[model samples]
Every structure is written in structure tokens, then in C-alpha cells.
Target: MPDRWDCVRENTEWVCKSTVVANTKEAIIILTAKEIGPEDSLAAYESHLKTPRMVPDAQGRPQKSVIKSVVSRKIAQHTWLDGLQLGSEIPSYYTRYLATVKSRLAILVTFSAHQRYFTKYSGDFFKAVNSLRIVANSDLLNPSATSSLELGGSEQIGPGQVPGFGSPLQVPDLDTLPSEPSGAPRNQQLLFLIGIIIAVAGIFIFLKRK
Candidate 1:
């Protein structure tokens, strides 16, 4: 995974965006680790999971929306990961959040176009995330498990150093996928080339006649 440097990126957010190419479809996942206060995640998640309550619009009429349940698990000693399945309108995709124990770090991971790809690659996805580590120990972040990044140059970059972390999961096997264009850019280019060739031929004939 490569870290993207842009205006939106900030010191608190360690965001890495990856494009996954599969046999049938293309998808993207954005991994974010943001610094937060100790134990801030639970409160935030509870607030988001609040029951469906109606608030009035300008017309004083009430507007309502469905509220979904939140699911969670302990990823490490104190570290945790939470997931909330979305509404029927957006089935097949869920929102997820993670907090590292004692490190005051929060992680956000989302899978897009999930309905189209999850069934085929769920195994690989889970297996890959297991490689995620959240400890500060350099020894555990061994060279064998580390991967090289192209953020600046060719130097290798390991996972962020938190307090305690390790996993049986490995880096995802991201299959290379060719992106598709909305239209045939190749055909358009071919037509442009033919037009130029015809123009050149006409010019050559005109000059010869002259």
C-alpha cells in the first residue's frame, strides 16, 4: 500500500488508498489511521449508533431514517474494530472503524463496490488485513514482514509503530486489473490519426498539381 500526499492529507491522518483489481470488477479501499484521544472511539461510535429519532424540517414536519446496529470485536489486547452495516439502499457495503490500544490511534477501513467483489475475494481481504500490526517494537516489525513503499523513493516502509500489535494475516494479494474508460478513447484516437493522414495526402496532391 502507498501513502498518498495531497492537500487533504494532514499530520493526524495516515491514509493509504489502494485499488484492487479482480477478475470481474474493480474496487478501492481507503485505510486511515487518525490520532485521537484515549477511549474516544467508543463514545463516537455510540453517538453514531443512536436510535432513530426524528428531527423537524423547516416545515415542522418530522423526517425519519432507519437506524442500524453496530458490531465490534477485539483485534488486539486493547485494540478494537467496529462495523456497522448500511441501509438497504446501499447493501453490500459497511462502514468500519478501528482503535489501537494505548496508542491513541483510530483507524478507518472501507471497502467500496463490495457487493460486486466481496463474495469472490472475502478470504483474501480478511487474510491480508491480518498482517496489520500496531506495536512500537521494531523487533516484531521484522524485515521479512515489512514491505517497500513508493511514497518518496524506493525505500521500504513498515506499518505504523503503535504500542502492541501482530497478526497472522499477510498483505492482500491485489490482482492487477486494467481500468476501463467510459468510451472508446482508442477508437477516437484512431479516427483522429486517419483524419490527419487524409489531410496530409490532400496537401501532397495539391502541391504536386501546382
Candidate 2:
């Protein structure tokens, strides 16, 4: 965890929040792990990524969820999703989902930030995500073989040395963010906080299907 960031672990998920930003505009990152079964294959993940999605807005109205980008790396599949309304707290949000399977362990790293601040803090978010490593048991056969997901390659940061909290995660400019009807400053932090919660929940829900 980075300085000024607090994390809580529940079963297979870890949710971390940055406190450097105001409470109204915080940033969040979630890491989740699952035990993969024989049926869970990388091809399934790719298909899911290519599928279109419809998300419910704050008013309970359905809206199209857009996949901004998708990348299939040797060891990991990365997807960027945007234009999803996560309820009143987060009228609009952005998410980067990095999925990989290593040693029969399926891992998903999710980073969420207010659409307006995502760009600013993305560096730290990705650094933390890429720093995660799974050490396969040496006794297992085919020790030389690696997982299909290539989650490594970034400069690693040591324990208790997570990326700093001073940056944003590549959010759009404030002007581009939706404002309240009354013209009051929106509570952007809630968007990030809620995004983390929904993301963790969604991960478990989806993993159960694998």
C-alpha cells in the first residue's frame, strides 16, 4: 500500500483507497484472486471482453457501456471501460481491468477513479497493479512454463512502498465531468469510492461463473 492509502482485505479481495485527495474526490484500486477451474480459459475472457454491455444509470435507466480499449497480451488481458453510470454517487466512471492466470490462480486488478481525475493518478495505479507477482510453487511440474497472462515488466515497488497518492489516474478535466443541476461541485470522491465497492462486488460475482 502507498503512503496515506488505507487497505482492507476480505477473503480474496483487497480494496485500497488514497487519502491524499479530498474525501470528495478520492481514488481506489482493487485486487482480487480466484482459484481457476479447468473450464476457465483465456479464450472465454477474450470473448467476454468483446461483448457489449448495458449498465443501469442512477435513475434506473439503462445506458450503453463502452469499451474504450482492449489489449491481449501474452500473459494478461486488459480492458478499459468507460461511460458507465455507477449510481448517483458516480454519474460517470472509468475502469481498467487487468486479468491474468498464474499457477492456476486467476487474478484481476481493477483501478477506478473519477472520470475527471483518472488521468492524473493512473501512473501510480498502474505501477501498483504491475508490481503484483505470483510465485509459483517450485515443486509443481512445468516450473519453467509461465501463465498466459503477462502481468509483469514494470519497475517493481517494494512492500510498504506503493506508488504515492499525489497523482490522479487519468481522469478527464473537471470541466468535462457532469455537474449538479444546481451547479454545485459534484462529490467526485464518492464516484471513486463507490466504484471500488461495485468493482469488488462484480469481480466475485463474475468469478463465480468461471
Candidate 3:
């Protein structure tokens, strides 16, 4: 894989595929992983952005703006993700997320194309980040060919991917899901007749014995 500093992580690789990438408002999105540092919070990294940074802009020189960040949440020592909004008026946003799972604080940083774009796409981004699971014991640094590649997680199939029991899986009744087969006639009527025949035969046997 290409070792682009802005897109790849040291321990794990991410698939940040999207259908949106353009010069338009918040059109480009990028994700990169770095070693979790003492600054586990998003605001913790604002000092780094104090210096002016520039990006390629076909229109003109890259806009220089004071980078300001907002911490979405910080749970003492549990899980937290902070958002950064760069640029003025029409802005750009970045999401910095960290989770302390079993003494390991995995870090993920995102660069949003635009603040407006980030807000529009934040829902999916939050969903993706919140669902992250890391296997601290497994060989995440290097996996065999048979090893399944997924975002660091413990969920076998994810939030709504189990049989009859995911966020998206709700069965109100037997009719909601296919048991034996779909559109197949049930044998309840035949079974009821058979049950009645057995009951009548048992009654006759009891009277004969009496």
C-alpha cells in the first residue's frame, strides 16, 4: 500500500472511500492514523496547528486561518473524539477521536474538506468512528492472508448485521422472517386434523377399556 503520511496509520490501515471529492465546499476528506500521544484529546493538538499551514488551491494561495478546535466529548479516561473547524466563515472541520480500550488509546484524525461539508458528513463519520473496535490481543500489526480485515473492533458482524437481532433487524412476528421458506404453505390445518383424529381415537380407547 502507498505510504502516504496523511492517509495511512502505523498499526492499522483504513478504507476511507467516499463518492465525494471535489473543490466544492467540503469536497475532500482524508483520514490518517498516528501514535496516540499524551494529547489524547482533540484540543490537545491545537498548539500544533498554531503555525500557518497551507494546501494546494487551484484558485489561489491556500487560505490561511487560525485553526480552532472544539472537543465534542472527553470521558475522563474512557472514550473521546474532538472536532476541529479550520478556515473562516465557510470553514473546514476535522475529527480527532481516541478510545482507551484495555490501556491502549488508539488515535484517529480526520481532515474534512469544509466545515459545512463536515457537518453534512459528520453523521456517517460519527457512526463509523463510534463503531470502531480494536483487537488489542490479535496480530493487528500484521495479519495472515486468512485474517479478516476490519476496522479495529470486537463486533463480529457490526451493529445491525446479526440474525434477527441487530439495530436494523426487528421481527414483529413469525411472518416477518422466513423460517422454513418464504411463500410456503404451512401445515397447521393438516396438523390440526391429525390432532383431532388422535384425540377421538384416544377417547374411543378409553371408553372401550372402561
Candidate 4:
């Protein structure tokens, strides 16, 4: 008769073996089986229990006996490698996963951090992380970077460039433009006043005549 056994770890199934003693470790597993030769014998009482009568071979052993086995295991013990801790200081790969939630969720969680880091770095943090999502299989870290808005361009005036908005561009004021010299403009001013008086007198005369 052949013996069968199974190995399991955590919630995952590991391997199945026959006639082997198996040992599992954090990073590796070992399996061993003894190949009983035909001449290997059990106690006489133990052999008597078998359906067929068994005789010891020339070496005074069992007539036939053999064992075969196999071993299989995972390459890594834990999902994370490099001995890094989880939570606040999680790995980059894991962070990318977190970003893949809805855009609102991403903003709720990553917006402040993104602003703080990118303000100093001057590069699009979400864009870089989104690019990483193309390779990282985890969807939890893939985030949309579309909410960012562009302020303005060269031709269009920016808020900072507008008047009273800290713009260095100097705009000439209408009230500051030069006026004709006051002394030399006296005759012209008198003529302008006389013309207004004559026009008013003509209007009164025309109304009386009507």
C-alpha cells in the first residue's frame, strides 16, 4: 500500500507527498522518503496482518517495499520583501496600489501629501505613480491624475501679471499724461469760453423768436 499526505501553510495549500516526511520553514521546505528495499522486513506479527502471506527474502526481509516522494514550496515567505515595515512607511509598490482608488478617494488620502512633496520636487507625483501602475499588477495603487488644472499661458494674462496684482509690467496711468502748458493756453481757453456763451445766447434768441 502507498501512503499519501498533504502539506499546507497559512491559508494556502502547499504540496502533497507519498511516503515522505516533510518539514516546512519560513522560507523553505524539505521532504524526505525512505525507499524500503524488497529485503526490508517488518516484524513477523506485523506481516501476518496482511491479506497475502509474506515471506522474508534471502536477507530475511520483506518481499517488496518502496517509497516515492516529492516536495514543493513558495519562493518567498511573505508578500513583501526587503524587510520593510508596513503601514505609514509602506513600500512604493504598495503606495501605488493605494492610489488606484476612485479619484475622490485618491484626493482625500493623497492630495495633501502630493501637494507637500510635489511643491518641493516640482514633478507630478500622481503622474509618476500612475505610470508605475502600468507595470504593477495591483489595481489599488493606480490613480487618475486628470483633476490637475493649468493656470494660464504666455499670451493670456495671468492673475499675478494683472494690474494691482504684483505685476512688474508698468502700465501708464491716463491721469498722468502731459497736458498743454497753462500760460500759453490762456487765449485758447478764452476763445473756448466765448464760443460757449455765444451758443447759449443764440439758443435763447431762437426760442423768443419762435
Candidate 5:
């Protein structure tokens, strides 16, 4: 076996394979020890092996054993795999389990990307995922302060301005007006009335004389 060969054992059967290849970027490798029994003849042929080598005979012919093991050795090379140590009372397949979870999450997030089904809640969920990513990389809860709540726009009002539900501005009280009079000056009003009366009186006198 090559130095890069990862070993997996299941049910007394061991197979050596590479967990991953840097140049090829392949993550899985399948190896066949040998072929046995008529049931696995096709698999044996596919593996380019003639007869089963590791296992012994059953009642009559050798029983074909099908064993599957993950490529753990090469998987350990990945940084993500370092958290998933095998056989330490913790789950032995944490790496594979997390990969499955991430895959499912990606699919769900992708499906939610369609516009028709994406509501405000969906947007919130997407934002939450983004926040998680930011939290993983940074110390701040909010990565951008400008992206906070909007202020002073068409959708918002100035400070101390209460929005009216049914009217543009609240109606003012009748007594709330200033005590000072707002009409013309008192002398100007008297002069205007006097001018009107004199004009009428002059017209009447002229008619009587005529």
C-alpha cells in the first residue's frame, strides 16, 4: 500500500484506500480484497480480481463478503476533519455527518432563493445565515453599521413629529389663536368706513338738488 493509503475496517475486513488526493481533488476510493460466490461475481469482475482472497469458505463455496469503509486517513489531512477524531467516545463519523448537514442546508438555502416563495421571513432566514458566517469570522455581531435600520426617509418622519392617521396635521383649537388682532389697523378701518359714507351722502345730496 502507498503511504497515502487510508485504512478502513468493518466486520474483520480491512481495505486500504486514499481518503483524498490533492492533485485530483477526489474524496473517495473503493478497493476490493477479492471476489467470492456467484452473488458478487459481477463486482469481482468489475474490480478486475479473479477470486475472493481475504475471507474463508462457508458451508460449501467461499462466502462473498462485501465490506465498505470510509477513506479516513486522507480525510484527516483536511482542516475540517481535525475536529472529527475517530473512536474517542464522541461520534466516530462527525466529519461525514457535518458534511451531510452542510449539504442539506445548502440545498434548502438554494431552494429558498426563488423569488416567488421568498418572503420577508425568508429574507430574515437568509440574513441569519449570513450573520452566522460573519460571527464565525469576526468579533462584532453586525459587520456593517450602515446596514442597520434606515432613518429620515419617505418611510420615516423627523424627530418629535407625530404621524397623523386620518389628517395631514391635527386640527387646532378655536381658542389657541394668539390674543393679538390680525385684521387692518383701527384707524385704517375707520377711515375706510367714513369714505364710503361720505360718497353715499354726496350722491344723495346731488340727486335732491337735481
Candidate 6:
């Protein structure tokens, strides 16, 4: 997680928001993990891309989800969609669904925001996604296993760790995923905050000298 994001645990879900853009409630990211069985498959989720189900928009009008694209890599699948269409008076709602499996563990991450404000905070969202890592420790592969994250980046579970239970489920076989987005900014808000504090201190020092 980015240092500038506020994250909280709600049962099995981790809800996160960019501190700088916290005012926009739609600027959020949610992550959940669970053990899967042989019956669960990525194909089941892909079916929705072919045939979308209607969902209510902000105005309470029914609209079908718009499929943007699908990206797949070894043990991972990505789906981008516009959940709500852009209207004359309402902004379009966008969401990215990312599912990854390793052994018996399946992880799902959802990133969402209104189209009007997505670009402003997209860097943080993508960074969070790219940072995810799967731990191979044996202790984490059981039903009673638990994990926690620290605030700083040095901790093993702080930034890129995924939380979940273990299973004997089977996952889809796929080729290697493409490289992550290299251009995304990291800890941007933290740097910006530091700059502001320095400027304020400089001004205060000048006034004190006067």
C-alpha cells in the first residue's frame, strides 16, 4: 500500500483510499482473498465480459457493463470495465478487476472511481496493484493462517503481500504475464507533502531572522 493511502480491514476485505483524494468517495480500492476449489475457474468470470449483466447507474437507470479489455498472464487475469455509462449529467463509473491464483489461493482486487476523477489518482491505484506479491512460505498455506501489514515499506507484509487461506483448488494454466507498468509514479503524495513542509519551514525561518 502507498504511504499516502488510508487502509482499513472489513472482515476479509481491505478497503483503501488515496489520502489526497479522499474527498472523492469513489476513489477507492478493495481487495479480498479466499481459497478456491476445482470448480472455480477464470472462464466463469470471463463469461460476464461476453454477456454483461445490467446494473443500476447513479441515476437509478439500468445499464450494462462496458468491457474495455482483458489481459491475462501466468496465474493471473485482468478485466477492465465501465460499470456505468457517461450521461449528460452523470460521470461514467470505471472499475478494474484483477484475479490471481497460486496453488490453492485465489486473490481478487477491485479498483474503482468515477471517470471524471480517475486520471488524477490512477498512479496510486496502479502502483498498489503492481506491488502485489505472493508469499511461498509454508505457514501461509493453511486454513488457519493469518497475515498482517505494517505502515512502513521495510516490513515483509507491508507493501506487496496478499492475505488469504489455502486450498487444493485447481487454477487455469496460462502464459507469463507481461511486465508491469514501469512509468507509474510511486509515493507521489508523500513527496509532495515533504516539499510543502520544507517550504513552510523556510518561510518561517526568514520571518524569524527579520
Give the number of the best model, judged by TM-score.
6
Full-model lDDT for every candidate: 0.32, 0.46, 0.32, 0.19, 0.21, 0.44
Q: Which candidate number maximizes lDDT?
A: 2
Candidates sorted by TM-score, best first: 6, 2, 1, 3, 5, 4
In model 5, pairs of residues that clash are 35-52
Task: Give candidate 4 regions above 4 Å deviation.
Answer: 1-98, 101-118, 122-127, 134-210
Put down candidate 3 lDDT per residue, 110-184, tens digits, no spaces: 433333345455544444444334323221222111222111122221112211121211112121111111222
Candidates' RMSD to native: 22.6, 13.2, 24.5, 45.6, 44.2, 17.2
Name the 10 consecutive residues with the lowest summed lDDT in model 3: 173-182
- Give the alpha carbon lDDT tens digit for every residue of 75-179 in model 4: 112110011101111111011111111111211011111111222211222222122211112222222222221111111111122111121212221212112
- Cα deviation in Å at residue 92, candidate 2? 1.1
Q: Which has the better TM-score: candidate 2, or candidate 4?
A: 2
Write candidate 1's Cα lDDT for 141-188 as tens digits: 111211211111112111111101122112243333213223211112
Better of 4 and 5 by lDDT: 5
- Candidate 1 Cα lDDT to native: 0.32
C-alpha TM-scores of all predictions: 0.40, 0.56, 0.38, 0.12, 0.15, 0.57
lDDT (Cα, 0-100) at 1 in candidate 4: 9
Evaluated against the true structure, the overall lDDT of model 5 is 0.21
Candidate 6: worst-modelled 10 consecutive residues by lDDT: 150-159
Runs of candidate 6 exceeding 4 Å displacement: 74-91, 139-182, 185-210
Clashing pairs in 6: none
